[model samples]
Target: MKTALQMSLAAAASLSVFTATAAHAHVSVSGPAFAGATHEATFGVGHGCDGADTYRVKVQIPAGVTSVRPLDSTFGKAVLEKNAEGNVTAVVWTKPLADVLPADTNYYKLALRFKVPDAPFTTLYFPTTQTCRSEAGVETTVAWSDTSGEHGSHDADAGTPATSPAPSLFILPARSPGWNKYTVNQHVHDLSVFNDALIVWAGKAAYSANPATQSLITTEPDTEVLSEIHPGTEIWVKY
Candidate 1:
């Protein structure tokens, strides 16, 4: 909807692109959780390594997330691994040697619920590893703990570059008045979130939904300057 207000947008600087995990059936997570909210993180493993059967699954708990409790799974009870200071560091799920299935026949979903920290946050990834073993005593492992690369908060048309992508979670911050800096976890197209902000600044462009401006600086033809929100976009919004 075009409003009567003239919005003046300008270019800022060049930026890198971000691609989140979605199409890949290997490993992934669910989120964009609100700051300070309790979240249940689920790690989905679709297959074992090199056609071997899965034997163990380990997931590292990121900082600031509190009160983590692993949910039960068919693989058995969840084992808590802690740090020297008595803080739980990771969660493990193991399958007995006799129960190891062959190849990709099994899909595993292991989850842990925890309370998120209050805002002044962005994206979080729980580094996970999947270990597989064969009857002959051969063990193969695939670690989905890479935290490199970038993606849009919207997780748009792009796919992750990680061969074994870790399950990721996004944090939606608690906004404050005046200017607030945020990273986009989900793609945003509507300008409503910044409705009252005087102007928003992303990489090489600026957006103002103040409805009192008089121009546009669109990078793409027919698309608004702020239309494409990157997965890891750190944008500044003013109230």
Candidate 2:
């Protein structure tokens, strides 16, 4: 019962909302974001291309990252592409069989661990391509390879293609002790091997690891002695 003008305006509003959602749904890489450290990068894929099923995801490794090892995924098989210098340059995870995955499966989370170079305060971009296959075997590729200006700014703009934004990680500066520091997203267990003289900063309080006791002891007696540090805890160790 709406007028033609009203209907056009409603459709435009819906389209704008859809575009904003799509722009924010681009593949993203997240991790400790520290330089000179071994970082586990998690590549998040929110959805597949349109209504298609994502069959494969390929991520290009930027320069200065080495010893790339893709984590195992229940949804797909991981493959590595090595350069002539025997260094990994890219990693691809492909579904072994379409029937093995759920019919409604669209989202994927892939991870890889690599050593970030000593370049501090730098942003690393991983250009990724997602291959979506329809039921009829039609393949569609969405490239997430834009590293211009600010992250997601270009894609969020109107008229930009959906799913053409690259995943980026902000490398933080290296800490002292000639060892890099990393802030994990969750509490870390099993710090037995790291029994050396290391420092852990939880909030404003600092705790040092006692090599003899293999425990983290607080500098201040009143401060809490932590067995397991919570998320956002920064630790500096000599690697």
Candidate 3:
């Protein structure tokens, strides 16, 4: 016979992924990547600046993400910018003037293959800048590089609308068919995203349907509960 906790955990789902793609959405990256795994992030561009056709797109790669290689884009040539340390700092895709005619008013997806950091439960942001050119030869740019607030404030996928939001997404641990263990690298405020998770716990702290009833935890005594899980805090979940 199976234990109640085992059955509950087995039936539970993995972590939650939050995105805020409302009106005036900026450049956004899409994916549910596993920790330390290779990911091909696709940044989506909806439109140009004030009806101007897109000419270039530059995406800034955050730290801890390694071995980045931008894929070829039909829109233009993809190039990478690297720091003195030999790490890729940014990936820029520029469309040729030949194709810019009649305005490349359509949406675009710029891809980059790389390895996410080993830290699980971390949200990484790729600050991006989009350049546009008008038929009259006027040029403009949109800096989608504000990585503040939830999921990098003003993100097209989540959080309060911002004037400029960075492209961001969570890199979580690879889960098995049953129960899985994870140690979060950031503070998570809401546990509701894991609604399917039957329970979550760390040390003596545990939560079933509400904030963990423990006063303090052995793992991370200060922030160990469903409502507030701090960094370096180890937790287990049912798949």
Candidate 4:
């Protein structure tokens, strides 16, 4: 007889397979808040380079979400640039002089402030970009994380860019009154022959419902591909 856990695992695996095949690149929005609450949101990025690729990122926010601007970023320097709309501006990160980020450095932080107006706060969506560059300054991989973990966090695997059996997650909460902290994860993968990497295409995400733990549901996505990532590549971008 199959054990109860085994049966459950099989079901979850089947669901994951379905999601992986149908996955697409998209952004996820999560929110429902009052006018005075501070809102914190964390964006997740998965996949990084070993010594081969350097990454630069830019996050764009919707209009009028908050009057507050982004403070100094932990990952790098941020500058306010006028958006296409002309009057509105968004925060953009300035890349360092270094052509390539050191192999050991794999994470960055971007903190923003959201000051709500007298009106009620509703849903806000942030669209972002990831630029991957090679030593020759050629572009490599660019990806974004949308889904939230139970609390809204994602793990990025640097260098490899291969999908694991585990599902990745990121979170965006509704508006609140004070400043909130959003933590993001970057997974480093060594896509070099010395590091040994597997190329894979990411599929869609699928979820499993569990009654025991209302919030502790299961999710799975499929990433399958075959090709070695080019060496000396990094990502760069500005919102």
Candidate 5:
């Protein structure tokens, strides 16, 4: 029989997986989440709204993101909507010659390239709106604007609605030469492979002495800090 502690740990792990799956259960954006980098943001449209065929999609550009340009798609014609300041605020893609395509065949995937802001350790949410037109000339709109709380507080049990949900990306800090950020689920042996790299956990930093060892040590060489880190730990390393 499993102990009480083991049972509780297993339940928590299961909940974590469920929550992550639920968060990405809508139209999502994919790209490099590095700060101040030029990247292609691909917006994936899984299906049409309800039973109607999606004819148009509009993605709101976040304030700090600039130089927005949508890529041409064979499924639709891309249009850029600019504000009075001449900054592109939104990019809309609409099916070309709607009458030519069958109502059931109106689906699309859109992409745009832009420069991410210089903000690090921040999350960016892009709210999207999808417009669908039924065979009877009826129009339906679905908005993907739901967001987490101000400080990135996520509600695991929050039920997702029929409408789309916003897609988000986390921006990381700029790294020095040979340094990179990695998310790990378990222990990472061979810390010495990366010279002068530090392990950061919960805002605390630790270093290792014998780089060839399988574990990391605290600032004090006599004290050992960790051999295996907690799951879902994000660490910055030079390797």
Candidate 6:
């Protein structure tokens, strides 16, 4: 009773539903977006290789980031990386958790200290990974990709079978937190610790939204800056 295109869109929509049900498939960052503000970036875990327990995470801080630090927890460890320019630096840090990734739940948190730049516009990238103790804690890398500036594309699950082309995940844009201050809280969700920003790509422009709205925020960036948030550049996680 439906045309091929209609059936295809229906399938795509179905896949999106399936992915949301498996919300813990990837690790992400979220929180408020004010400079010198510390927020919690939550790393989610679900449906990965069976027996795979998320152990360590590495977050790459983009240029123009300031006052970056990880919170101390049962699974907290981190370090800072200074840039060649000296003024700019990326926070290359990792942490160990008390609990491993649960079989059917999202678990993890990280306390992060971050200051937005002076500029009104900028991009932040976060490249992260999860390790399973079974492989001597072999790190399973989680790649970051963003639509150039397009909005609302990641309507499907990462593990779902594709019947059509998938919408790309795009990194959002953020503004500098000049003199303003925000607070970071530590809480356990599902089974993982999370402490970071939630970056949302709503449309042509990217903006960091509150992680609480992760369900509403879109991850598709515009097509122009397709590779701007490439996996290797470090994922600047902000919500």
Question: Candidate 6: minimum summed lDDT over ten consecutive residues — where?
Answer: 186-195
Candidate 6, residues 1-239, lDDT tens digits: the string is: 11432343334333331012111225445532433334344434333445565555555565566666566555555665666666434333344444554442345565465665443222244544444443445546443333232112222232343332212212223333221222212111111111122232212432222332332223323312111222223223322
Where does the lowest 10-residue lDDT sum fall in candidate 3?
210-219
Query: Candidate 5 lDDT, tens digit per residue, 1-239?
Result: 12432343334333321011112634677743567988787888777766777878888998999988899887587899999999999999887545433355544568899989986545577888888878777888988887643212222312334234577655544566444776654333323222233333322444433332224233334444543344567765532
Candidate 1 lDDT at 172 equals: 57
The C-alpha TM-scores of every prediction are 0.64, 0.58, 0.75, 0.40, 0.63, 0.42
lDDT of 4 by residue, 201-224 (tens): 122211123221112222221322
RMSD of 5: 11.0
lDDT of 1 by residue, 1-239 (tens): 13322223222111111222332326767554658878777777777777787889998988887898999898867999988978788999998777887654788788889988774335577888888888677898888876644322323323445555566665656666556888766665444344445667786566765333414444333435666565678898755
Q: Rank the candidates by lDDT, best first.
A: 3, 1, 2, 5, 6, 4
* Candidates 2 and 3, the one with greater TM-score: 3
Top lDDT hit? 3
lDDT of 5 at 142: 86
lDDT for residue 190 in candidate 3, whole number 0-100: 52
Q: In candidate 6, which residue ranges exceed 4 Å CA deviation? A: 1-25, 35-50, 84-106, 121-123, 135-139, 145-239
Task: Tell me how far candidate 1 lies from the true structure as C-alpha RMSD in angstroms.
Answer: 8.7
Computed on alpha carbons, the lDDT of every model, listed in order, comes to 0.65, 0.62, 0.69, 0.36, 0.59, 0.36
Each prediction's RMSD over C-alphas, in Å, is 8.7, 18.7, 6.3, 17.0, 11.0, 14.9
Shift of residue 151 alpha carbon in model 2, Å: 1.6
Model 3 TM-score (2 dp)? 0.75
Q: How many clashes in each candidate?
A: 18, 0, 6, 46, 1, 54
Off by over 4 Å in 3: 1-24, 101-104, 152-160, 192-225
Q: Residue 3 deviation, candidate 6, in Å?
A: 48
